[model samples]
Target: MKPSIPYLLAYAFTLASRRADEELREHGLTVRQFGLLMQLRLEPELTMAELARQLGISRQSLHEMVGELEQAGHLRREPGATGRTLRLTLVPGTARLLFDAHGPLMRAEEDFLRGMGKREIETLRVLLQRVLAHATDDEAWLA
Candidate 1:
């Protein structure tokens, strides 16, 4: 019997995450940290709760990670529109680190997807986006 799609996806995610972590480690960043920074870079106005949800981490865990990044000067917290919400931002120092890390990460992805043709990759991306859209009930999952 073939493995379930979810099982295959989980296995693939683990393998890909391990490779990404290895690549990111060269820049002194973890996969989670890099993801957090990337999210902030993509959406500068994301609130703590929103960011935590997007990252699929608990608020407490996000807070801890945020603290670590903040201490390392990679992240900054600023006032939000609401008094109870805090906005997350990547500091200037992280720009260089993230820029430097991009190449290694892309290389890792290319390595992982080795032997796949361009059309296969695009099909996989579209399918994943559809799944995400359905799961999240958000049409803008690709955005």
Candidate 2:
């Protein structure tokens, strides 16, 4: 029997995430950490407060992750509106890791989109995006 769209999507995302995790683990990062780093890379002046809000994580958790990255030389704290703020350090080595990881990450996405044609994938993407948009605004949509 065929699973529902939600179930299938969940399973496929999980499968892809697992492989992505493996690749990230090789660089000592989790998905969340990578996202954090990416955000900081793009907006190198974001305060820790802004980052926490953007990432939807508590300040304490963001602080912890920032601490780890700082220890690993992946990021640095710099002057903000106030005393200091967190921004990712764009070291060449880390940039190289990001470049190295992109291929495998995209390959996983391509592999997921294989069976479905381009139009079908676009339709599914739009539908899922709408669902998520509605879900974020309404408790009933979630229930």
Per-candidate alpha-carbon RMSD to the true structure: 1.8, 5.8
- Against the true structure, candidate 1 reaches a TM-score of 0.87
Write one digit per residue (lDDT tens) for candidate 2, span 71-108.
Answer: 88877766655555434455657667666767766665
Clashing pairs in 1: none
Q: Which candidate is the best by TM-score?
A: 1
Candidate 1 per-residue lDDT over residues 1-143, each given as its tens digit = 99999999989989999998898888888788988998788789888888888777899999999999998889888888887778887878788899899998998889889999999988998999898788767676676
Candidate 2: residue 65 lDDT (0-100): 90
Off by over 4 Å in 1: none
Model 2: clashing residue pairs?
none
Span of ten consecutive residues with least summed lDDT in model 2: 134-143
In model 2, which regions exceed 4 Å deviation?
1-16, 84-88, 112-114, 123-143
